[model samples]
Target: MAAKRILIVDDDADIREATQICLEITGEWEVLMAEDGVEGLAIAQLEKPDAILLDMMLPGMDGLTILKKLREQVETQTIPIVILTATAQPNERKNFDQLKVAAVITKPYDPMTISDQIMSVLLTSR
Candidate 1:
């Protein structure tokens, strides 16, 4: 079976690198990254990755806007989206739930367990 491909969209280079390293090493998944929302959205459309790990706060577009745009397009509508947030506020969580996001992973996450969390969320979402 082919390994799962995941796209991570975040402005923080450190977050993107750490996530890429962890997912690649621990989950054995292909990791694609984008530093800003515009690039992230473009990559999502072009790559069609199996899942998306999107940062809630971003430059140029923000996560909610990107999520809405992804949902509006047929090519990306069905892709599972896991939100990476520093603060999962009640209202934001509600919005994410309404948008049918896969999960909301709070930031400052444990690198050792991040892959497991992502994998588990994807499985349960399916």
Candidate 2:
């Protein structure tokens, strides 16, 4: 089978690298990355990745806005998005839930377990 392709959008270079390495090693997945929301959106539309790991607190376009935009377009609407954020408070979580995100993963996550968490969420979302 072909490897799953994942797109990770985060402004933090360290976080992006760690996640890319972790997912690539653990999941044997093909990982694509973007520094910010605009690039992320462009990649998502062009690549049509299997899933997106999006950071909630982006500099320009926030994760929620990106999510809304993705949902608005037919080409990328069905792609699952897993939010990576430091703020997963109840109210924030509720918002994510209402937006129909595949999952919300809190920041400072375990690198070793992140791939599993992402996979688990993707599976359950199906």
Q: Give the winner by TM-score.
A: 1
| lDDT of candidate 2 at residue 63, scale 0 to 100 | 87
Off by over 4 Å in 2: none
Lowest-sum lDDT 10-residue window in model 1 = 110-119
- The count of backbone overlaps in candidate 1 is 0
Q: How much is the lDDT of residue 51 in candidate 1? A: 94
* lDDT of each residue in 47-101, candidate 1, tens digit only: 9999999998998899999999999999999999999988988999889989999
User: Alpha-carbon error at 102 in model 2, in Å?
Assistant: 0.6
TM-score of each: 0.96, 0.95
**What tens digits encode model 2's per-residue C-alpha lDDT throughout 1-126?**
788999999999999999899999999889999999899999999999999999999999998899889888898999989999997888888877777899888888998898898889889988
